[model samples]
Target chain A: MSRHRARRSGLLRAVLSLGLLVGVGVSGTMAYWTDQATVTTGQLAAGRLDLTLNGQLAGPGGSTTDTTFAVGDLVPGESFARAISVGNAGTVPLDYTAVSHTNGTLGPGLRWTVVAGGAASNAGSSANGDRTGTCTGGTTTFSSASAISANAAAPTPVVPARRPLAAGASETLCVIVRLDPSAPSSLQGATATATFVVNGVQRGAP
Target chain B: MSRLRVVVLNAGALLGVLCVLVAAALWVTGSRPLVVQSDSMAPEIHAGDLLLARSIPAADLEVGDVVSVVDGSGVRVTHRIIEVSESGAERIVRLRGDANAVADPDAYTLSRAERVTWVLPGVGSAAAFVDSTPGRVTAIGIVAGCWLAVVLPRRRAPLHARPRRRRGIAPVLVGAALLLPAVLPGARAWAIFDDTATVATAPLAAHRVVAQGQPQCRNEGGLFGVGEYVRLTWPHVDVRYEYRWEARHTATGEVVRSGVVQPAGGRPGELELRSSVLDLGLGATTYDVVVHARLRAAPSWEAAGTTTQVRTSAVLLGLGVRCA
Candidate 1:
């Protein structure tokens, strides 16, 4: 009994001493260099995706700076072309596209074709500063309108590499809207409006 | 003839088996170990420590993971990932040292696990030394000599040789000798930085100081972001800290930006020695930041009509365990 008691007391004493040493060591005696640093707590916001439309928007008016793309009256088989330029003002590159939505009975009688860099590419790649969004020699035409054509199915995309417009760069698009030459005379009094909607998203992540 | 002898022999056999098993497991896992050589990640990790890292993809890395990557010039750096940018199939990772005040001067591409998962302290110093040319030769000679001393003596002994009285002691001694390497020296370098008094007029009252004691035994990666800010403290009010900051080119290891800060006044709180904002310029090259913290303590005395002083330094006395 005494032997067991002695051993227990000794063990308890050792534990107490260890606990005391650990406490003292943790509370008061560091004589070495210590370092502490933290990153300021904040979330990195995504880059801006601002796309601007300039130049002539083909519509009712010939080449007005007006926001309304109003193509007043067009005789059957007549074709009208207008030059429009899209610029990326944001810091990062952007993927942009243009789509037209029509509302009227004559909507099916019209067809459109888009040619990129119709005039911008003439300046040459090195002729100016910040021309990342400038379009190359690429063209896409929508000949017929589907009965239920939504945004994606009817949109015209810029040329490859030109699709992602670089920051501070612009692309000039020449859109030709024409009334199909085979349109019947039954659509004479029908009026239609084609609204050009441009959409853009940043190419890479934040 | 004794249980003690039987136990020692069994323990030795067990240890040998365990060593082989562990080595095989590490090999199968494809994990590699590297030695740390600087205090850029001090407090969390230290110089003369070995790090076990597994191969992992850069895309899967998180912001706070400590990863090892090669800079543009092919310099291997271990730092925490602060930001990541993806370019096509590759990832451009930006790293920052924990003790740094800013981001790395440049970023690195992460394609492998070189990410640190385990830190084995003090033993790395011996491993590093042994890996060198002269050290390697000396180690091989010692191992070979020890093997010969044991095997040759046993081979020469008769098959029916008389039993030795000290046979039991031999196994115990041999077991102890083999277990010595795994004991691992407890001493590692760490410092305390008290930034509580940084605000001149109304300093924050106090910081919970974790008093790490002197290790009875003794035995050190990178990017940079906006520069990092670092702080170190002296426990008393009468101490001087002399610190030097060096920014070296990762590839050629040339010092580019170097400066030293020696505080004129001795105060009882942590000192902020570096600022977090860094101006590394826009370049693809990476730089490494190294800090040299030296503390000088002076106690006052009376001599003649003026007060004289005795200087004693309270520098480098803690185990590298807790992070400030």
Candidate 2:
């Protein structure tokens, strides 16, 4: 009778052990699968941006011209009053701002402002009729603004601007400048600087 | 005490034997099967079909033989031989799939390096499944069960007697039989060929002029180049004929000059001709001379002339001689 009872208990213990092992195995497998699924789905929401710049303008005073960007090279600073067209050929929208990083050292009458969307007619005057002052000694004051639109047939000039870009959209920003006769003679051939800030990221040359 | 110990030991031994058998089976037949995932080889093979393949001797291969070869990236491809050649002591073979209209990008040379063996029809799906997590778990469970049976005490037969013979052979044999399609053509002999020759000299002219040569044929009549000759070789054979030329006074190094030469008469190996021309052009100087040659291959005859294909290779010749 005792032997029979002992055998019954052993059998029950074996069955319970087997059940526990199966339960642990199943739960582990389920956890692993869940983690894998999450990782795969999380990878779907990422993107990147690519920027291209074209053309530069420079002169004794100030100048403007259209430009195109090519792969694997930077624009020289010799160009003044340049027209920069930026293209967004990436999968994400581009939020960008343009700034001049050079010290105010253009000629006595030199001033630089960005004209977004549209041609620069006077080359040195803002659409709002603002004329920047000339250089005092070696120092010239140039400012930039947003709200310039490359999509407009005629763009307005501003100091700081905000622009929203859809993927694959492009905009042309015109650099307008004026050179003062009182400015240093060496300033005539110096390279103007333009800094491109896209999606809060800064890149460019002065 | 003796009787009880004997019973327990016997049970344990039997369980151990069962485990070893299962393991041996899995070890032998587990890794050789593969599943088809694409319809690229349709008509002759389809997606989801199983393929069983085993490593075999390259010398045993023939032109029409279907073989599975792993490429540089480790992806396996099953195709028929289109050409074979030897360069010095090195043996090279070119392959193309039945469904493809063109041969592969480059010839695969296998001397003592690497070779492909025969391919089996459909049988890779199970192997693919076994590679997955769920299948792995099942396999682990089977192993654990065998282990448990071996480790448990058998002096007290739990309610029922353990079967005198375990049926472990069935699953293993079935698995191997399923993979048999991948391994049937174990031993076979293939054809041999002579080594290919290289050009005798560089064919560039000055810094800007290039001269080219074309293989001219003078049969019963006058001489003619590529358009006049109809070269033919047996099925599953690759034949290359070289032509040379030179160029003169080309402006920019980027300038490319292209032309096409086709076979004149339809011949048995005519449809299989593949051609490519290379401009060996030189840089700088006024005239960038270039000499070009075309390389062509015949289609595989193993498919009983069912498929027609052509391929080409080109080279530029020179970089000197100012045009202005």
DockQ per candidate, 2 decimals: 0.01, 0.01
In model 2 chain B, where is the ten-residue run with the lowest total lDDT?
Answer: B193-202
TM-score of chain A of 2: 0.42
Q: Could you give candidate 2's fraction of true interface contacts?
A: 0.00
* lDDT, model 2, position B76: 49
Query: For this target, which candidate reaches the highest lDDT against the unseen true structure?
Result: 1
Per-candidate TM-score, first chain only?
0.54, 0.42
TM-score of each: 0.30, 0.27
List all candidate RMSDs to the true structure: 42.0, 31.5
Residue by residue across A130-174, what tens digits does model 1's lDDT show?
112122355653334432132434533323232667978987666
Q: After superposing the true interface residues, what Cα RMSD does each candidate give?
A: 32.0, 25.4
TM-score of chain B of 1: 0.44
